[model samples]
Structures are given as C-alpha cells and as structure tokens.
Target: MKNYNLRSTDEHLNNLTSWLPNQTVSERLANTGFNIKYFEKLPSVINHCLPLLSALLERYDSRERCFIFNGIKCGFFLEDVYYCTGLPVDGVEVTGVVKSNNDEKEEICRMYLGVSGLLTKGKISLKNLRDRFINAEDTDYYTRAYLLYVIGSFIVPDKTGRSVDVMFLEQLKDIDKTGTFAWGAALLAHLHVELETASESSLAGHSYSLMIWAFLHIPKLLKLLPNTGRKGPDEFPLLVQWTNWLSLDLKNNFHKNLKSKFSDILDNLKDEDIVWQPYKNLQNLPNDHPQHRENFLCRTVLICYNEVVYHRPDLCPKQYGIDKPEYSGVRKEIAIYKKQRKLSGEIDWSKYTSEKGKVDYSKYIQEWKHRSESLLKEALGVEEHSGPTLSSTPSSIGNVRYDCSNTHFEDDEPEVEPLQPPPSEDATPRTQADASPKTPDDGHGSGGEEITWNTFYLAFSGQAHHSTG
Candidate 1:
C-alpha cells in the first residue's frame, strides 16, 4: 500500500478530493440549513477535516494515517463509563434500572439532549423503530441516513475480509471469506443517521452521525468497561431463548433473515461458556456497574432500552460495496429506494419520555415542543419529496422509479438493521430488491414492499401522517 502517512495535509486534502471528490455532504447539509444549527453547539464541525490535516501535517505514521475508529485505545475513567457504556449515574455512583417513573418507557436514546419526543405516560410511546422511520418526517430525521445507505453500498464491497472481531465468521467453515469491513456497527450507525434525516430538507447525515456519536459516547466518552468475567455460552443460550420470546420484536423490527437467524445462532454457541455470559456472577452485581447497561440490554434482550441513543461509535461500521451475501444482494437504485422508505423510516416505539432520558439521552433540544416536533422528525427517519408510491403498475415493488433528483450529495455512512417490533398487518415480502444494472438510479428493493406499510414515525402527536415528513 502507498504510504498515506508521508503526504502533507495540503496534499492529503487534495487527495481526499479524489477519494470522496465531491460536495455531497455539504450540499445535503444545506437542505435543512443544518450547518448553522449544528455549529451552534459543536462548532468544530466546520473543521472536521482538521484531524486529517493534523495527521498529515505532523507526519503521523501509516497506521495513524488510516481512519482509525474510537475503540483502538479502549480505556476511560469511571465518570466516562456512564456515556461509554451508557449507564445511569447519580453523583459518583451508578444508579441502575433507569430513573423513568413510567414502567413502559426505558430510556435509551443517549444522544442529542437525552429526552424522548415520543412519550406521554410511558408505555412504548410509539410502536418501534420501523414506525419511527415510516413517519420520521413528523420529526424530520431521515435525510442523511438514506444518503449514507446509498453511499455505503456504492463505495464499499459488501463482503469484506476485515472485521472488528477476529472470531466473527471463523466457525462458518463453508464460507471462505467475509467482506473486508465490519458492517454490523456501520448498519447500526446508519440507522441513527437516517433517523436524523426524517425531517424535510433537514440536516446532513454526517451531522446526525456526529450527534448520535455524542449521544452515545460524550457522557461516558465511548469507553467499554472491563469484561467482568461475562461468558458467551451462558449469555448466548439465554439470549437465544430471549430472542424467541422477543420474536414479534425481531420479526417486526428487522429483516426476515435476521428474524430467522434470531434463533439460528444457538448451535454455534452451545459449546462455549465465555461466549454466553456477560457478568462474572449473574447474581453477584458489581458495585460500580454502570446503570445504562441494564436498560440498553433491556430493549435488545428482555430488558428495556434507553430513550436516548449512545454514540458508542466504536461499534459503528464503515462503508463497503454490497456484493457479499451477508448484506448486499441488489444494485444501487433498488438499494437507494429501500433506504429512503423501507429502512430508516421504521419507528422505535420502545421509548416514552422522562427527565433523565432513558439509557441516558443527549442534553439537547433545549425545548420540549421543538424536541417533540422538529427534532423528533430528525430522529424518526422521514424525508422530503416523500409522496404516494410513484405508480402501482411498475411491476415489482423494486422496479418503480424512486427519484432523489434534487437531493444534496453525501457519502454512505453505513447500514443499520434496527431491533424493532413488526406491524400487526405486515404482509409477506412481495419481491426481491433489484440491483441497479451499473446505473445509479435503478429503483428497487430486495424483497421490497408492494404496498406502503405506513411503518410509523413521530407519533408523539398521536396522529396519522399525510405524507413523508
């Protein structure tokens, strides 16, 4: 590989032009005039490229020159753990089980002002993430997420040989090679940014990415606590059983494959103990246990999830092209449409509003109405130009012409398959999302929808939507 470390910042900046080489991020950011708002709080956004500048100017080595993720060094202070692990805190101690008085709403949002916009008297104020995405425009959050989904598939190869965990695909002997990237984290992160895009002509996905990162990380500063003798086998079996218990959640919220495999990983972990358990002694709790882990796991496992999102970005995945069977099975056009409507638009009804913000929310919004209205749209994954499905006679759901002609350009961030609850009326997958034939706008979705599901979003107003937010 060429020595990226040797280049100067000036040279690298110019080189980046060749890599990204466009104004996609800035253009889309203009859609919501988000640059102004984003800068209002974390003004450093304007100079995001500075880190690269510093690396180049200072002549950092080859490894440093690479875009390293947050988990590399992996250590932090106790105070930082709250945000890192997304635990709750009181003075200096960890307060578990969330401070929400309502039993239904487990706070897990963690980013951007820390409170939920979708609640009233608790009880999953909305339905789930798919609902959030379908109606995101009520809050206007889907702008960037949709774009990144497109870009991630466009730029990176789906099946990469690289992975964050060395053992991720090791046991699947039949599979020779995975992709060169870790897509799981990226998929999760992508869900977050798209949530920001739900608004009409709103902030850029990069801005949302940064915000979610703050929500998940800033407080605890993205620290992963030392493993307290948590075993995989113990936890895996329990997790598998719980996955079945949460079948409605898995089926409704994620893809069919995920739903099928939700219970499919058991045999893999049956022989391993370290792979199952997360804590040393299930009964014996650590005195310093971060409170958020309980709530975070609550939503995913049987435990409640936080209303606030954690920016544990180390878990965030980077871009890779979609060719690998694990993630990609279609082309750009169909991929783009799926992202715009099917993916980010889903609702996350697990949350309801409270003060401490479930799972530790971001200290954002500064106002209730704004957080409930505009900000909610930003988080739900709605978008502009949302309209009646272009036409009915387009043959397959993935064959119609889904247009984003006027959209601001942005690079793909990642794809996130959220953990959600399915619609009571959800129908069987009608058709596969068609891959664009080397054409960027070949509209389609793999197993795309034939009818609009009204997935749900920004239901804080407790009303049906007219169109895309």
Candidate 2:
C-alpha cells in the first residue's frame, strides 16, 4: 500500500483539517491511547475510541442525530479499526462474523460491533456531544453532517426482517429532513455499489448483508428530503459510481460464477412471495425515484439469476415482471437501466447542478479543479509537484500495528484480468432481458422454474447460504 502524507498541506487537506480536532493527528491519537492489540470485549474499543469520537462532536455544533462523513472530508475510521486489531479491513471471512472457535477473530468482530454501539447507543448520547460543541460559532456544517453519517453507518441493528427498530426508522426520517447530510446518503449509496461489485461468495457475504440492510433502509432517508424538486447534490455521482462498478464487475466476471446460486435460490421461490420489504417501503417516494430503486434491485437480481425480460410486458399476471414470463438476454434489464439513467462511467462534476444548499458544491468544485490540473500535469510530464510518497513506520495502536504500508489496498482493488476499457457512451447495446418465472399459456413461453419465498429469504439472509455471490 502506498502511504500518502497525513500532514500534507493541500487545498483538500486544508479544507478537511479545518474541521478536525484542534490538535494534530498524532496528538489526538496519543490522547486516545488506543494502543491495545487484543480487546476481549467491545467496551474496551469504545473506551479507547471515545476521545476521537468526542473530538468529532466538539467540531460539529448541533444537538442532532444527522451528520456526514465522506471518507475524504474526514479521516477514515475503518482503517483505525483495523489498526486496533491485526484483522484485515476487508474483515475476517467477509461475513464479518468472527468464528466462535477462533478467540482472536471473534474478539475482533466483537470490537467492531462494540465501536458501532458506542456511536449509535452508547451511554453518552451523541446529543450530548452536540451540546458540547453547539456553541462554537465556527462550526462546519459539512463536518457536522459527515460526523453524523459516521455514527449512522454503525447504526445497523442486530436483526434483519420486519424486526428493525422503529426508533431507527424515525431517526432516518428526521435526519433526511435536515438536508445537510446528503454526503452521508451518498456514502452509504457508494457502499451499496461496492457490495454489488464484491458480491462473490466468501466471508465478505456478511459485509454484503450489512450493506444490503443499509440500502434497504436508505429510502426512509430519501423519502423525507425537503421539496427541492431536484435530485440531491450526491445523487448523480452515486449513480455514476454504481454504473461504473457494475460495468467493471461484468468485465472481471466478479458476479459470473455466483450468478447460478442466485438462480438456484430464485428458482425455488413461488411467484407471489417475491416481495422484499425494502422495495415495498418506498411507496411514498416519487414514482420515478422509487421505480428506479426497484429497477436497480430487479436488474441486480436478473444479473444474478441469469434471467432477463427485454421489456416488462403489460399482459404479465404477476405484480412485478420479475416473476412472470418474457424472454431476452441475461443482464439486458441492467443495460436498459444504464441507458435510461445516462450513467456514463466518467463523472464530470463541473456539469452537476443541484439546489440543495448555498455554495452546495464549492468544496467539491475546488477539489475537481485540483484533480483536473493534476491530470494536465501528468499529461504534460511535468514534475513540478512531484515528491516521494512517505509511509509511516509500524506503530501498535491497539493490538494491530498502524504501519501505513500494510493498508488494505489489495483487498479493495478489483482484480481484473486483461482490463477492458470503460464502455463508451455510444457503445452498441447488448441483447435483451432473459425470462423470469412464469406460468404456461401466457402468450410468452412458461418461465422455466419457480422459486419459493422461503428459499430466497433463507439465501438472502445468510441462513441457507454463507457466501454472497
């Protein structure tokens, strides 16, 4: 892993550090004393991370549950979690569950859940954190928004299904109304994109489930946005990110082998039982937005099931075309979705327009300009800004070493063989959608096999299958 300077003074870093703790990173790390390698319980990790957490609350001046934490605007927390333990940031066994038999791995998992617990429901209410800093005149709303997001990302509940806490749903709605945390929404959306890309079966399946749950509930936030009429500032970038990930995943066959397992699960479900709660909850959203989420889900399922229906037929008896007949090529639905959304792989933020806030994208616009200049320099073979990338020596934070060189770059980068160029805007469209399950004599041929609701639920919830893909 290449280690970038943590103290580098640049337009981006300056903007970020402006909202960080008053002290330097090293000073803050020392104040936290988070140098333990193995924690037997989650409380231990919480106790250690509290200083860092407190510093964040002190920076944001609002007594509220919502804040944003773009990994860029704020220093990343997952890496710190990894620093506390030797565990890979990709996490042990992707499911993120530590095996009971392995004391060390189990401890790591406990620590992760524990840290999340502290942020969301720890004894010190995040409300209290806000009160402490609420009087600061120089409070950075962007930082506050990002901080709230950091806390929310860890807000996943223990149960899956209809058992989600009512408080959480209400909290999501309240936060969404604020409209200051679009960056958080965008970050969670990006997580969903990452999950789809890494959908291969592995321990990572558990990580995927956590993200899926986040996606499932995000509509609660989306539905509550103020009447801006336009999409939030983060929406288009997220869409572009999602499409690029899918395009790249296809090229690398990331979802190829695992596609059959989804079919196996889907084929066992009965037509009437395919309704997922997440899809049903979006009823209050504008027709276009909710439909888009549904389309994404259906398209993803089609990709997994290796079944497609070119166009959703009106004559189909089923509520969703997912369960009915209509034959076309695999991944065809996804292709059409990409076309309708105009999700080109490249995101030109310069062309982005949103009415969310005053100076809504001033910071991002600056960053984009910087990036463009860097590219121009690279093109011209200029070395004006060149310098050696300095990495930090290994230092034990908790149990794991914080050596910058050991970062999880390999785990994160997509493994693509013979990398393919991103698809051009004018690239020829592919074949149409494949057939979904359907009964006979429906004009279209009978959809091959039917899948039971129980089967799909089991696979999706990680009860029947351990892998994600």
Candidate 3:
C-alpha cells in the first residue's frame, strides 16, 4: 500500500490552529522524543498524544468539530481501522473496539481519553510555551474546548446521531464572576448550535441549561439595549433593541474590564460583508465609544457568518468557520468594523427595512435560491434537458481496487451449442422395428425401457437441502 499521509488528519486539524488551540502529532512527536517508526505502544506516543488532545478543546474559544483525515496519506481502509498502531501510523488502525481484547489500539484511545479528562479538569495546563504566551484561564478554556470538539467529531460525522455525551460542556455553562466567560458563551453557543444544527437523534442534554435563556435572553445580547416587553421568540424584543441598554449610559462596559475574557469571543464573531466593499461602512464607530461590547456590532458579525460561513465553509475566513479565524488577521478586520460602527451609528438597513433588526429575512434568503427549471426534465431523464456529459477518462471517485470478474457462474460457451440432437432416420427405423412405433418407447432395448427416472431419483434422495431462511 502507498504511504498515505498519516499526517493528513494532523494537517487537516492543524489548518484550524490559526484560530483555535492547536496540537499536532508531528509537534507532539518532536516534543516527546517519539520516533516515527517506533513500536505503537511506546511510552512517548501515549504520553504525548493524550494530553494534547485534551488541551485542544477550549483552547482558542471555539466549538467546532471537523474531520482530521489521515486516511488518504496513511493508506487506510474501513477494514484497517481495527489495526491502528505503529508510527507515524504506518498501516495500523485506531478505530473499532478499543476495550474488549485489551488490544493495543484500545489501550491508546483509553489513555488519550484519560489524559483529556485530566486536562479538562486542569492539572495538566501549560503556561508560557515556545514564545507563545497564554494565561491560566485562557489555556484551560482552549484546551478543553478543542478536546471536546475533537471527541465530538469522532462520535458523529455529518453532525448526526451522536453517541458520546459531552456533559462536560454543561459544566462550562456558568461563567464565574472573575474567570473565563467560556462557560456562559459555550452554553449560549451550545443552545444556538443545538437548536439550529444538532441532529434529532442527539439528545443535546449538554445544552439543556441554556436553551431557555437563548429563547428568552440572547436577543438582548445582539443589540446595545436591554430586553423589554418580556419573554420567548414571540415576545422577543427587536434584535437591535435587545442590547440597547436603556442604561447605554452605564458605559457599555461589557468587555473593557480586565476581569472579562469576552473580547476573544467578540473577535470570533463572524461577519459576512466585512470582506467585500458593500458593508464596509457598518462598523464605523468612535475609537473611544463607551460601549466596550457593542451588541449590534456582534449581531452583525453573526449575520455575516450566517451569510458567508454557513452555506460554504470554503468561503469562511478560516478553515474552522465562524468560531475561529487567523487570530491576528481576523482581529484587524474586527477593529476596522469597530471603527465603522462607532463613526456611522447604523448598518445598511435601507435594503432590509423592517422596523428594527427583524427584516422578514426571507428577502435575503431569496438571494441564494436556485432556480427550479430543469428539475422536471431531470426526473424524466430527457436528453435535451439533462444530457450526459462525454468524457474519455475514467473517474477516480468510487473506484474500488477489487476485481470485477463474475463471482457467480461457470464460464462456458453454452449459447452456441444445441442442448439435444435429433436421431437419424436409420436409428429411428431400428427403434420402431422393435415395436416403439405403437408406443412411447420400444420396450425391448436401446437402453430406453431398461432405465427409469425413478431409479435415478432415489440415489440422490438423501442429500441435504437448505431451509428457506
């Protein structure tokens, strides 16, 4: 087998590091003295990879789960998953059951899990490593968030039918007054994610704590005002008015205080038009505006992500989507928008035009809709409407390595030969001469009268037969 990059998983994952906490197998190997060809059960492999997975979870303040595909580079097949061992990850498999036979593969996964749990609990937190500086709280959040997202990706792809319980996320729902705001933000984001994206099969118990508040309190976070007129989606205050802080006079100090680490969260907020010139005027605000956390500005970022990131992750500023971006690059963009909003005092509303932040939104949704012209033609398979494209080359997609030879039948040139031959006139005359002309067969000879089908049937009568099942 070709050596597919066992690093594919690491690279795909590493691509997201610009935004979130990052730890790669390559980096871990370098740090822990792990030899690429060493035994699968080496101490360094376990010691290095375990806590690394744990630390990535909440590392950069995002909660995205993406696949780290080393399959192509590592020469993996679904069948090989049971044998994950060796390094870089030669031909070993890391999936399937890791517990039953006490297999080496299982042991490794178990070790990784244990390390992750410990890191999330914080005994293994890192301080200032490799010129990259992070505080205790920042370190804890990123590590935990990254691990959970990675674990969740393992549990479900296509974001469906999750079996792993991320109850740990619920543990992060409440932010203590002096520490990480990750708990509350995660809780709220969890609610939005579950409500908007979780598969029905997933219980979403991890987010049970915040779903009510999302329906009740979160719209207020979108605007610079406080919520009024009471509860629920039906009674939701205007998205623009929710954060309007009748107490806007209280200094809009949501993020300026050193105690709150919420600036990271605000920075991660996605905005659509910030890229093109169209919405460039939106973030125009005064550099010293009293509001440190602008609700309307944050909401605009979400709107931008909803437009640019959701439909196509490719369009997102970073591979990881809305939660993270290349930290420095994204922050620069946010700073620009901050300037826009502080100076302009409003976003582009002439186009959307509802009384407040609600635009019926359907008009914007219509922009991306596809036309339905050929669907009927396609269903009928009409060549005029849906003709097949001609290509001389073979497709690589769906190509299987196994042979295409027929497995079911014996090969023989049977179609060209007759099953039975007619007797010649001379032979017929002889059988008739024996008196077969008056009956179905000649009773005397030619072996016809001597043998009976009944005798033949009895010889094979005891052979076994399979039941219909």
Candidate 4:
C-alpha cells in the first residue's frame, strides 16, 4: 500500500523513476511499450507522474500542455496521451505546472504516452484495447468486463462541447459478440444515450445510431448478463422481455424493412467507416461512400421509431408502467432510441400494441431449477426412460401398454403382486391352512374361515365387500 498522494514536484519525479536506479530514463522509455500490468500500477503514481508527462508533452513543437483555457479543460492530445478537465478525474487534473521545451523531453513523453494510450478511448478504442492488452486466447467474461471498464473511462464525452471524441464509436464495428462483455458494453451504451438525448444538434442523430447498435446487441447482452448481482429476480428477465417487446414493437410500427435497414447499418460499419467529427462535420463525408448510406439507414430507422412512441403515447412506458426506467438510465436510452426514430407516416390505429412480452421470472430465480432435465441426465450419465421393447399386453386403463421386458427398478415404492381371478361357484374354496405360506391376509373373516369368490375379488382391489345375511 504505497501512498498515492505526492505533494511536491521532486517527490513526483522521484516516485516516477524510483523503480530503476541504474538505468537512465531513455533506457526505460525504449524498453517499456505499455501493458495491463503497468497501467494497473499507474494509479499509485499518476498524480505525480502527470505533471512530468505534461512537461514532457510540451517539448514537441506540434503538441503543448493546455490543461485549462478560460478556466475549463480543453481536450488535448500529446502524441498518444489525452488530457481533459471537468470530467471525472481519471488520472490527474493539472491545475498549475511549470513548462519546459527541449528535445531531451521526447523520450519521457513517449514512455508516458505509451501508458496513456492504453487509457484514452481516442487512442485505444475497445478494438485497440483487445489487440494490445488482452491476449488472443482470453475469453472469460469477467476479465473482458474489467478491461472494458478501465479503457471506457477515458471515453468521457467532452461536456465543454469544444471537441467531440467520436473514436469510441469505432467500438460498434468490433462488437461481434455482445455477450462477452455485456455489462461493460451496456454501461458504455447508456453513456452515449445520455449524451445524445441531452443534445439538440445533428450529433443527436449519430447518437441515435449508437442506441440502435445497443438494441441490435440486446440478444447477446441478455444471455451474458450475470444473474446473481441483479436487484430482483424479475429485473434481468423482465429487461430481456421488455427489450424484445420494444424491438418488435418499433419494427411493426413501421415497415418490416426497417428491421433489414437496422441490420444493414451494423453490417456496413467497418474500420474505415466515416464518422462525423466536431471540427469537420458531415460536409466532408461524400454522398457516394458506404458511410453515407449507413448514416442514412440509421436516421431512417430512428425516424420510424420516434413517430410511433410520439402519437401513441401509451407505447411509452413512463406514462403507464409502474417500473419507471429513468432511474436506471434505461428509460432515457429507450426513449431516445424511440424518439429519434420518429418519422412521418399515416397512423395505423388498428395495429396491435397490447402484447407485451412476458418475463420468465422462474428461470432466473436462484432456488428454482433452471438446468434442464436433459442437462442433469447428461451430467449424471443416467437415462430418464429406457428404450422401447417388444409389444406387450395393454393396460386396462387406456392405450398405454405395460411392456414387461422393460421393467424399471428406479422408484422406491414397493411393487404389488398381480390379483387372481374369482373362482367359479362349483370350485371348492381353500381354507386358510390349505393356502400357501406367502398368501397375504384377506382382512375379513379369521384365517380359519373359507375364502369366498366375492371376498377374494374385493380384497384384491383393496376394498372389502360385506355379504348380506
């Protein structure tokens, strides 16, 4: 537990390079490229190291350390390092620092930026993070989630509106499997919706596309969500069912091709896809490219969704449902996705809107048996029912045949012996003494009494019949 609070510049400099005394700063920079182990260790030294990083960044004539302009932080990129102010303090918020300009500073800047690149989304999107920090063989859900969070931190959209970090949008292209890092991806999606719905500019349209991306990935997201950490048993399943209902509801409200259009947007997003920028708007985006059509499809789908929720007010959950979603950030995401999708169309008043998907609460309940019988059978290596046998006598009850060849000794209950038919009137009745030793008691007259035909039949059925004198 090393103390993270470093007060002075000397202390900061000392803490930053104290690990290796013999090797020069230039030596360390050339050797260390940046990995998870180093990034995890940054927190303890970040407060101290950032000032040195800022000073080093100033050495590059192209880059300058601009922490606050007009009392607000400007989003500045120092080679690969990103610095911002007024957002959640990820590393260090530089207030006051001395500036230095020289070629010698470049080596230190390279070392700091290498680590910083791993943090910032502008430098390392989810795709870059996966390639750099995570090994190709890794597939564990928890590990992917942890990595997504650490990387997602720097994606904080510029609240100052000075510049927009749209590089995070590249994550949409790499989301091949939503279930792998669902919770983390959901959190990131929620952040986008919040920013988009809050805006009144053309950026809102792009934000809508991000929301649709989240919707498209809902299937994998639902499947991967860890069940135990949820607030209630119904929460997780109910979310799935609700998302399912809303997805179809939005599609049915518009034309069925809206579904295909949504899919088209996903399919077209590539590493080279053109995303809108703060400095240069859609003006730079050519009308002929694949990116143009992708953006068009996104807006088209968004317009359709918003129109239905607008006129048909009951379709919005906030107006009617007890479970208001605004608290959890879901309502805003859903509302924006629905709101931005609004387009001009004739209202089909007769279209079905009442069928809300049902949540299987029992499936998520911890105590309930969620594992299928087949799964248990496969695990235990025991067959539930034996294979069919040769034809046998049918039971008197119905068409069910009692196959004697396939006898089951599975259940604990004792088997009953077959009942004998009633004897004819002329046949002599056997006394109890003459009966076999294994014969069960008739529960009527004493053992010495004669066993009558009616008595035998009644006893076999477990019902006694008293004869009239």
Task: Give lDDT per model, in order.
Answer: 0.19, 0.19, 0.19, 0.19
- TM-scores, all models, native as reference: 0.18, 0.22, 0.17, 0.18
- What is the Cα-based TM-score of model 3? 0.17
Q: For model 4, what is the error of residue 366's alpha carbon versus the real structure, in angstroms, after optimal superposition? A: 38
Clashing pairs in 4: 302-340, 302-341, 303-341, 303-342, 303-343, 304-341, 305-341, 306-341, 306-342, 307-342
The local lDDT score (0 to 100) that residue 315 gets in candidate 4 is: 14
Q: How accurate is candidate 4 locally (lDDT)?
A: 0.19
- Assess the local accuracy of residue 306 in candidate 2 as a C-alpha lDDT between 0 and 100: 9
Question: Residue 51: error of model 4 in Å?
Answer: 46
Q: Give RMSD (Å) of candidate 4 vs. truth.
A: 36.6
TM-score of 4: 0.18
**Candidate achieving the largest TM-score:** 2
lDDT for 440 (candidate 3):
14
For candidate 3, lDDT tens digit of each residue in 219-262? Answer: 32223223333432221111112122221321223222211222
Question: Model 1: runs farther than 4 Å from truth?
Answer: 1-46, 50-203, 206-289, 295-469
Error of 4 at 24 (Å): 37
Report the Cα lDDT for residue 89, model 4.
10
RMSD over all Cα atoms, model 1:
24.8
Please report the TM-score between candidate 1 and the true structure.
0.18
Q: 1-469 in candidate 2: lDDT tens per residue?
A: 1111111000010111122333332232222221111111111111011111112222211101111121101111121111111111110001001111223322332332222222221122333334444343432332233233222212121111111111121122222222221122222222222222221111111122222222222222222222322322222112112222222221221223233332233223332333222223222222223212222111111100101111111111122212222222222111111101111222222232223222112333332222212110111221211221111111111000000111100111211123122123255422111211111122111122111000000000011111111
Residues 1-469 of candidate 4 have per-residue lDDT tens digits of 0011111211111121222212232233223211122221222221111111222122111101111111211212110010000011111111111112222223222332232334231222333443443433323322332223232322222222111222222222223322121121122222222221221111111111122223222222122222312221111111212222323222212332432333333334331232211111112211222311111101000011001111111111111111121211111111111101111222121121212312111211211111111110111221211211111111101000000111101112212222222233345643322322221112211222111100000000000001010
Writing each residue's lDDT as its tens digit, candidate 1 over 1-469 gives 1111111110010111112212443344334221212112211111112112222112111111111221111111111222211122211110012222322232333121123444333222122322343334422233322222222221111111010110111211111111112122222222232222122221111121121122122222112112212222222112112222222221112222321231222112121211111222233223334322321111110011111122221111111000111212111111111222222121222232222222211121111111111110011111211111110001111111111111111213222333222212244421111111111222221122211101101000000001111
